[model samples]
Target: MLDRFTMPLTHRPLASMARYLSNRQVTPDQVTLVAFLVGMSALPLLAFEYYVLALMAILLNRLGDGLDGALARLSGQQSDAGGFIDIGLDFVFYAAVVLGFALANPGQNALAAAVLLFAFIGTGTSFLAFAIAAKARNVERPNFPQKAFYYLEGLTEGTETVIALVLFCLFPHYFPWLAGLFAAGCLITAATRLWGGYWTLR
Candidate 1:
């Protein structure tokens, strides 16, 4: 939901960084792979109960998420394959964080993590499915013109999810409650995306 605003604010800085990296011959795909690897490190950190360290790793992953896209555009190397890699790994990373929580304390967090993962299916499918149809129809998302594909606006977007994850890491004991709340938001996003996408497509 807040992505529209946050993206523009980060663009300049990310662009500058992208330009520097581009000069160094760094490719977007390379940045993406490194980011995913670093992000995956959070799983072990979380498993070992290093919440603060895990949080830092997660944040770096998120930063790289943005940076890769910026680098792609800056270096004029944006490709469907690159975008596909970026988004696909994103869902994996998001779910991995939840799994990390479950692994950290299975008795308390497993069920909640499962529920959140289920909710993710709803949001993820709705987002990707609509993007495909929208792209077919030449539908545009002015709010996210930089995006590789059109997507429905929703209550639970990348920004909100990151905030929820940050909170989860900061207060691991509250994972169940936080996961429930975020999962509920994902449901809302899914419902709205389904409804809005249907009408918009028609």
Candidate 2:
């Protein structure tokens, strides 16, 4: 939701770092893989009830996530394959974090975590499906033209998700309520995307 606004502010600094890394011959794919590893590390930390450590991992993961794209663009190595792996692994990472919460305290968090994951499916599918159709129709995404695939705007986008995850870590006991609220937002995002996609394609 806040991605568009944040992208401009973030892009310059990330690109600057990317330039330095590119000069060192670091590939965006390498950054992406490392980011995934770091992000997934939060899962174990969460399971062990290490909230502060988990928060740090989560922040680093998101930083790597943003940096990879900047590195790709700066190095002129952007490709469909890079985008594919980035998005796919991102979903996996998101799921893992939620699973971590559930594992941390299944008695309290399981149901909420499950519902959140289900909502993620809704948002992910609708977003990807719209992107595919938009591409077929030669539709442009002015707000996210650098993306390898079309970016469908949503109420629960990356920025919002990050905020929710941070909140989850800050107040582990409130995971159920936070996950539930974010899940509802995801559903709303899915519904709006679905409606917009239908009309645009028609």
Candidate 3:
């Protein structure tokens, strides 16, 4: 959902970072590993109620996430294995982040946290289903890969949700409100993706 707004800024920086890392003999797989490790560490940070540190860790992880693909393109090392690892690790990281938040404020907002987690499952499954069907159909359209590169059209994506979660962490007083908002967005995103898949696979 929010990836497109960042593209204008991230594109050049990512390209430059990829070029630099590629020249330094760094592998995209290594970058992916490092990013996943950093993201995992955020779990403990959340356990400690270190909201600021968790936010920073998540941002850093996202930075690495963005760079991996660019690094792959620059290094000419794109592979199915790399993509699988990237996507798989991403889901784990996302779930961890949400769990962290839920644990952090469990006493006061268990219901909201559970709802958010449920929405996460629904949204993730919907997006994955659409992606699988679309790929199986081999429906190639111009700039379609850009959806993976930088998701802009959907109501929500990793980037936006991370930002929203971070904001909610910063403002815990509004956590339930944010959860409700995100839930609505998730429904919209699912519907949009279903429509897209229907049209693409028809």
Candidate 4:
């Protein structure tokens, strides 16, 4: 949703950092791996109910996520393999954080977490499935030309998800409500993506 607007604003700063890292001979894949590790660390923090620390990890994880792509472009080292690994690990990191919240208070959070994870499945599959078909048809991604795979815009995009996660950490007592609301948004995103993909392909 907000991705298109936020991306442009973020790109310059990220590119500057990317240029610095590129000069240091850092690989995009390394940045991706570090992002995953930092994101994964948030899982345990969440599980232990360390909301502030987990929030910091989440922010750093997102920072790494953005910088890696910039670094890839700066070094001219972007590849399908790098994008594949980056997105794959990102999904795992997302799931782990949800699980961490569920573990923190199973009696209150489990059901909501489960529902949210299911919604994630819907969004994730729809996005990837569209990407595959878009690739086969040679669809152009003017909005996200830097992506190695076809980029599908959605109602619950990266920006929205991050906002929801931040809310979860800040208002831990409201996790169930926030997760439910976000899950609904994710489902809407999935349905819209499915419809858009079908019409676009047809």
Question: Which stretches of candidate 2 lie above 4 Å from their native place?
Answer: none
- Index of the highest-lDDT prediction: 2
Residue-level lDDT of model 4, residues 96-143, one tens digit each, is 999999999999999999999999999999999998898889999999
Off by over 4 Å in 4: none
lDDT of each: 0.93, 0.95, 0.76, 0.94
lDDT of 2 by residue, 138-181 (tens): 99999998899999999999999999999999999999999999
TM per candidate comes to 0.98, 0.98, 0.89, 0.98
lDDT of 4 at 56: 95
Return whichever of 2 and 3 wins on TM-score.
Answer: 2
Task: Tell me the deviation in Å of residue 39 in model 2.
Answer: 0.4
* Ten-residue stretch with the least lDDT total in model 3: 143-152
**Any idea what lDDT model 2 has?**
0.95
